[model samples]
Target: MEPRQLRAIMLYEHNLGTSARQTAEKINTAFGQCTIAHSTVSYWFKSFDKGDTSCEDKPRSGRPVVFDEDLLRSHLERHPDATTRDLEKELGYDHSTIIRHLHAMGYHKIMSRWTPHALTDSERAARVTICESLLLQPHRQDFLRSIVTVDESWVHYNNKTRQAYWVLRGERAPTEPKGYWELLDEKQTINATICGEQLEKLAPEIATKRPKRLSVSLLQDNARPHTAKSVRHILEKLNWTVVPHPPYSPDIAPSDYLQIIRTHLGKELVIYDDHTYYCNVTSANGWKKYWRCTRGGGTRCCAARLHLSPDYKVMKIINEHRHPPPRFIVRNGVYTKIG
Candidate 1:
């Protein structure tokens, strides 16, 4: 396994109350003798004790392994739950190679929120009882035969439309439903007005789903539409409490806050030609820095990058992006981070 990946395992073992010596012995036995020294395992455990569980190399690195980033992405598309070690079976890569490329491609093991809503205690108990009953039943084969399993996937396609409608098309296909443009307009641009409306729409569903609860806690990102005056007013009128969010948080998952990895310059920004670039690679040489589009890792995966000299002057531009700029919301007038 790569040093970082192995350190991750050591952290995991520490969480499970395993001794450093035991973890070292286990890993060495599985991989080979002297694969990982007991001293190295203990050092990592000490680092974990200090609550520094970062797996990235501290700068200088090594190795000449071929860990296909595309194949790993494809594997993840098919098996989102696959662990780092699990990639070895299909990718034909060693632990170090896989870990190196995964980190290089900005991949990290994250907990997947599988269900839209969580099951209640009673619902969980009922499911447990149902599973127990099925296991105890003698006609287990019959039970299996009666159930159907399927997977959900997204399919996209495009078809050309005629420049103009023909006479053969009767009534112009009912004009494609009334207020179609209005519906599209409402969703096309989600500003303060639309965001407020969406919250109002969600109010009823929350009330219906969690009727017994006296209050609701709504957590949202620091997006402008989400925190605008109209949206805040709507939330206040609905009596929903809004959870405070960090100004520059890239993700708003509740679990993410549990392990805060504060960056040296939290999402450093660069403004050029009315366009924004985020600090993708930190400049340690005191001469040049690398910046990337705000939406580089999202569905758009914008490839745009900006190179800057030590004086913060633009050195070069790479590619183009077609996504909205990131929203920066500081609590006070202070610029905690900027270009």
Candidate 2:
């Protein structure tokens, strides 16, 4: 008999002190060792009396497990960030049911969200080749003059977007709906390119003098609109250089440069669904007032200057700081920092 079967038989005889028929049932329930049938188990004892030891128990049967511990562990190790929902969908199982099973099996998702991006070895190699093919152009004056910084900003109305709650003692706070954006009139602005044309319209004097005209490289995100055929053709015709900012790098943007400016300007200029002033608040017409200016087509002059002390020289420090602290020491604390 195999060692495992022999052990099973010996355990049954020693522990239960019962016959093989009841022993097999106890083994199946206690150890999930369901290979031996009642008849086979009985025969084993009878044959043992005759000194004919043998291996006869067949393996268990089922629908066939698709994922064993090794396979599941491999998947989980490769996708550490995968959520229960993600694992359930990918492995073809009911989420709650899987969750219950995983709980019983002592497994848990490491993260709340996980969306795997599948790319083959060849595909990754091809991507590397394509990325390398993006040849860097030589530095030129024209490129510098053409550069424009494109970015996005959100505007909220009613009240500034903040999280807070009104609650009674021992009572849960009122919760806000996720579809608040649809309830209110919010605008998403995609500010593209602060170019010569834009600057000219923005500040006539600066445009007239050309401000030491040299080619400026345009700064933009990886949005398709930035590299659209029409946009590219326009930039090409103007001989403007286009350069993309690193993806998700806020340090390169003016917003980060003027972080205080944004904080100070907060709800005074911007609005959102979280605005307390707008909570369950609607315009008199029950709709947001739309203006052509809000559409972001024409140029508008905003003569806001960087908040610096009068004695502070703009050019004295080539790169004063990536981010300047709020003008705490300036204006004798009487005047706030400029936007």
Candidate 3:
């Protein structure tokens, strides 16, 4: 039975002076046609009567206040320009105490950071115009075909601590879990791009064999280096087309494809076999499957067939095969590898 029901039975037993089981049976049998044991009901009666109240719910104790109502009200009215230390000095409280007061008063900290495409209205329009003119030109395809996307991003070497968790009132929150941030000395932020050189490395089959006749259309944001005269002149000399994106349009860029590629790449073992598969997906290219039938014989795999639509089930199978086997690998390695 629930504690509340037991408490209720106890209350009835205390007020009526009945045996615990009899009271429980009476309470249960009264409306529901069910009887609780008389002995079990008596235990509740003893517990309820021993305490000040028979109610199951307990009272809550709120956080202690650092300042009185008048001081808090005054501080709220004049805290527009006050720092935590300033508030501390004015209210005769410590910095943490002032911070707690501010939190209680519904203040939160804000994070401010900057990235590419943080441009003004005129700057953005100028970029969009460049892209539009290139698109409108007849030679656009010559440049677009050669264009490869490039960008860099971060990866967690280790799983970081989760930010949100459950906690009771007045209880301190737990810290976030740690991950890759502490590992490798190389760099936390990896600068990658599908630019010329990186593109060649990513797809050597095409990069090494394809001639300079392949003029790629390069799309980038208005970062300082990207907008500089030298950057444009280099692209022109290489017979490449530079298509600068309007501010904040990554959602439509080819690099957006790369983002999806990287996310899947990070979880690569879970979805793919090697870096080639990763590049293929991001390159807007198709796949080349090499399947074989074992003793549990199935149809021989299709070698050179064209299809209008892909089988999602086949993709799911590929993804399942990507991740490294788990517990089995651990068990097999433990005996032989561990000393």
Candidate 4:
């Protein structure tokens, strides 16, 4: 039997007013190989006599105790970004003890929210004005259904960050220096033309999947290519309503806030019909494969590349193209870009 079980039996004997020696004799008679020392029973009997009912051993004097909430709160106020490990070092407590106390105190670590750019007072006012105008539109739900948001981002040729790993003593941990310029993959900037035209082209198919009364309202940042005359002309011809947005407010933009493109790319294998894709040798690492466009004589195609995981899930589609997909392919009653 375990020490706890033996202690429980001792407590029961004490409740009956049995002496410590009598309890020890009864324990030896009931459980073989559990011959507890007589002195141990005497110690427990003393505790039970004093109204201690717990069967578990008492905490040792040297064992770590729960952290002070006031002290922890003050420390966090000074170092809001300090990690749990950092707190352990500073407060001289185990990681688990700190975590338990934090839970009891209702403290939780939260990541800082990311914003595309810090908004000035003027920008904030503009955002509010645009939002108020949008809300004032007669057909608000219809407008929302018609809104097609778009944004552009650079896709790095190589992973910008490296992961840490365990290593044996005397063996150095692997290191990939950020300053190794050659190790960095080429960066590509995509334009908004492709996104606008593709949405226009896909309108009929997208409509078939939804209610027929919906119209598309294009939402895009004020990037150069997005505001270009040619892009606006195409949007007008397609009859897409353009939604006004403030500069550098990606946090409010549906495309950035909802992460539509990122989620779409991460879930499926996507191919563009108009753009020819070639395997990029520079990014054929085990975790990801990169494919670049072959348009524009290798210089001018939408600077985007498709990143795929080993299992063929599209991790990301980097950059934007200045042109639309050359053609749409209809297969099995579904219109899809070429894969």
**Which digits, one per residue and each the tens of the lDDT, describe model 1 over residues 266-339?**
64455442235666676566543787766646575876688877666567876343332333322222123232
For each candidate in turn, the TM-score is: 0.24, 0.30, 0.31, 0.43
Tens digit per residue, CA lDDT, model 3, 4-57: 765765786678777665666667777454545666566666666677554656
What tens digits encode model 2's per-residue C-alpha lDDT throughout 194-267?
23344335334434556676454656555565666666766776566666454433333443222211233242
| CA-lDDT, candidates in order | 0.55, 0.41, 0.44, 0.61
Kindly report which residue stretches of model 2 are placed more than 4 angstroms away from their true locations once superposed. Answer: 1-72, 75-135, 140-146, 154-210, 221-239, 244-261, 265-339
Clashing pairs in 4: 146-217, 190-320, 191-320, 274-326
Best by TM-score: 4
Question: How far out, in Å, is residue 66 in model 2?
Answer: 21
State which candidate, 2 or 3, has the greater TM-score: 3
Weakest lDDT window of 10 consecutive positions for candidate 2 = 270-279
114 Cα displacement, candidate 4 (Å): 2.9
2 versus 4: better lDDT goes to:
4
Give the poorly placed runs of model 4, Cα more than 4 Å off.
1-67, 151-189, 192-216, 236-239, 257-339
> Which is better, 3 or 4, measured by TM-score?
4
Off by over 4 Å in 3: 1-9, 21-34, 52-127, 138-339
